[model samples]
Each structure stands twice: as structure tokens, then as C-alpha cells.
Target: MSYPLRRRLWAAALILGFFVLWEVLCLALQVSDLILPRPSQILATLFSRMDVLWPHILQTLWTTMIGFALGVIVGVVIGALIGTSRIAYDTAYPLLIGFSSIPKVAVVPVLVLWFGAGPLPAVLTALAMCFFPIVVNIATGLASTEPELEDVLKSLGASKMDLLLNVGLPRTMPFFFASLKIAATFAFVGTVLAETVASNKGIGNVMMSASSNFDVPLVFAGLFILAFLGVALYVVFSLIETRFVGWANRKSDFAST
Candidate 1:
């Protein structure tokens, strides 16, 4: 088998082993389903209630995507500013750092108070959760551009915009994509946090409702759904990264082999 196939097989085996162990432990210890439902039970709940759960899943997915998209746009703009202009970096970086330092959960209430619940607060929370990483990565990528290369481009009469479009942004592709993977997960967290606190829709709200009724299996199922969505988005971005920046990973792939 090829190396990639072998790696995939190993991953599948590990996941299967984990579920098998979990099932065995639950059975052997007579663990109460209320505390930690067996994987089998969770799967059953997921499939059985999927009809009811579908709409909430869509809500959460939509909210997360909107937030993540907005985060990317804002992050790129701010990062470009910080990376390209020393004055912006000096003026804005500290404030950005302070904002990112605030717990996203804490901000969710303020958002809900201002926006009054529903998808808007969730979307904004996800946006807040994801903004910092992309900003940092983009700024780092732009800042890392070689000075010698910049001088050569300038000597060739390249305008600042030309240098940014042709060289700076291209050099930032790898970092930007890396940040996307991280930001995707954060976006989901932010959405869920807001949903649980203020909204009546989405997986987070579903989980909250389930927990209130002591439906542990359904709660776990919601968690599984979130995990699945997060992984799906991560894989999508990974494929896009490979398509765009496979060249960047060539060295690392070779070294790993």
C-alpha cells in the first residue's frame, strides 16, 4: 500500500480501537448511561433523532460559516495593515492583543445584550473567536517577507500595491491557510457558546436542552455532531491548502518520510 493509504488505515484503526475500548469499559464497569453513555448508545441516538436534529445542525453550520467568513475578511484587512505599516502595528497591535485576551464567552453576553439573541450574536461570537489567529498569521507572513526581495522589487519600479499583491500576499498563503484550520474550530466554539447562552436554535442549544431533561445520549450526540462539523470544515480547508500551497509542505513531507 502507498504511504498515504497506510497512514489513513492506521488512523481508522486507532479510532475504531478507541470506540471498542470505550464500549468494553462501559459494559464491564456497568457504567450508568446518564454519566457516560456507550458509543453504541450515542450512535443510536444520533441516527434516531437525526430528523429532529437536522434543522438545528443547519442553523449552527450556517452561523459558523458566516462568522468564519467575516472573521477571515476582517482579519486579512487588519493583518495587512499591521504587517505593512509600522505605525499601525505600533498603534493597533496592543489593542488587538487586549481584545483577543478577553474570554470570548464573556463577550457573548455583551453581544446578546446589544444584538438581542438569535443568530447574530452567535455569528459575532464566532467571528470574535476566530479573528485573532488569522490576524497574527497574516501579519507574521507579511512581516517575514525578505527585505532583499523587497528592495529588488522596488528597484524594478514595483509600487507598494504591486509588491503586496505579487509577493507579500503570496508568501502569506501558507500561514493564512494554517490559521484557517485553527480559526475554523474556534468559530464553532464561539457559535456554540453564544447559542447555549442566548439562542433557542443550533446544536449548542440542543445540547443545553437535552442536558436540562437529563438526556445524556442526546447531549453526546450533539457533541458528536459538533465534532463532525468541525472536522469536516478542517478537512475542506486542508484540501484547499494542499491545492494552493502544496509547494510549501513539500519540504516537511519529505523530512517526515
Candidate 2:
């Protein structure tokens, strides 16, 4: 098998082994189902309570998708502008760093007050968490463009727009997609955190309610669902990345071969 295929197989085996070990330990220790439910129990709870969980999952997914899309759009525009312009980079980069450094969760209350405790706040929270990585990655990609290649473009009498479109933007595609994966994860996390803090309904609300009633197994079920959703989002983004950035994958394959 090729190296990539072998690596993938190894990873799958490792994950399966880890889960098997976890189940064995849980059985051996006879751990209370409440404190540390086995993976089987969590899976059982998930299936048993699917009807209750699906709507909450949908709500969270909607909010996260909206937020993530908005964040990526805005981050790409802002990052491109800042990265390509020295003046803009110097002026806005520090401010971007400062804002990104601020604890996003700390602003949840203010977002609730401003946007009210609903999907709006949740979307805003997700946007906030999802934007920074995209901006940083895109900016880095733009800035790291090969000076020699840029000079070649210039020598060909390329207009600023042409340079940006054909060179800068293309070079940044991989980094943009990389950031998208991270942003997708953050989008889900941010939505859940916002829902937990204050929301009418969501997976976070369901999880919180379960915790309040001491339904530990249900809480684990909720968490399992969240993990599944996060992985799903990441996989969706990866597929999109692979589709849109096919040249990157092709180049990688050529190099490996």
C-alpha cells in the first residue's frame, strides 16, 4: 500500500484499539454508569433519545453553518486587504490580534444583551470564534507569496487586480481551506457555548437540562452527538477543500510519487 493509505489504516486501527481498551477498562473496573458510562451505554442513550436530540442538533447546526459562512466571507475579504497592503497590515494587524486575544466566552453576556438570548447571539458567538483563524491563516498565506513569482507577474505587466486574482488568491487557497476546517470546529463550539450560557433551545440546552436532572448518561449522549457533529462538519469542509483545491492535492500526490 502507498504511504498515505498505510497511514490512514494505522490511524483507524489506533482509534479502534483505543475504544476497545476503554471498553475493557470500564468493564473491569465496573465503573458506575452515572460517573463514567461505557461507550456502549452512551451509544445506547444516543439511539434511544434520537427523537429528542435531532431538533436540537438541527438548531445548533443551522446556527453554526450561518456563522461559519459569514465568518469565512468576512475574514477572507479583510485578510486579503490587510495582507496585500503594507499600510493596512501595519494598522489593522495589531488590532486584529488584540480582538482575537480577548476571551470570546467573556463577551457572551454582552452578545446576549445586544442580540438577545437566541439564535442571533449564538450565531454571533460562532462568528467571533470562527473569524480569527481564517484571517490569520489567509494573511500568512498572502504574505508568504514568493517574491520571485510576484516579480515575474509584475514583469508581465500584470495589473494589481491580476496579481491578486491569479497569484495571491490562488496561493492562499490551501491556507484558507485549512482555516475553514478549524473555523468549522470553532463554529460548533461557539454555538454550543452560547446555547449553554443562554438559549431557548439547542444541544447545549439539552445537555444542560440533562445535567440539571442528573441524567449523566443522557449528558454523555449529548456530548457524543456534539462530537459526531463536529467531525461531520470537519469532514464536510475537507471534502469541499479537496474539491476546490484539487491542484494542491495533485501537487502533493506528484511529490509523493
TM-scores of all models? Answer: 0.96, 0.92
Candidate 2 lDDT over residue span 1-257, tens digit each: 89999999999999989878888999999998878888888889899989988899999999999999999988998888888888999999899999989888898999998988999999999999999999988888889988999899899999999988888889899999999999999989999999999998999999999999989989998898898899999999999998778777777565544
lDDT against the true structure, each candidate: 0.95, 0.90
> Can you write out model 1's per-residue Cα lDDT over 10-90, one digit (the tens) per residue?
999999999999999999999999999999999999999999999999999999999999999999999999999999999
User: Any runs in candidate 2 off by more than 4 Å, and if so which?
Assistant: 1-6, 249-257
Clashing pairs in 2: none
Q: 152 in model 1: Cα distance from truth in Å?
A: 1.0
RMSD (Å) per prediction: 2.5, 2.2
Task: Extract clashing residue pairs from model 1.
Answer: none
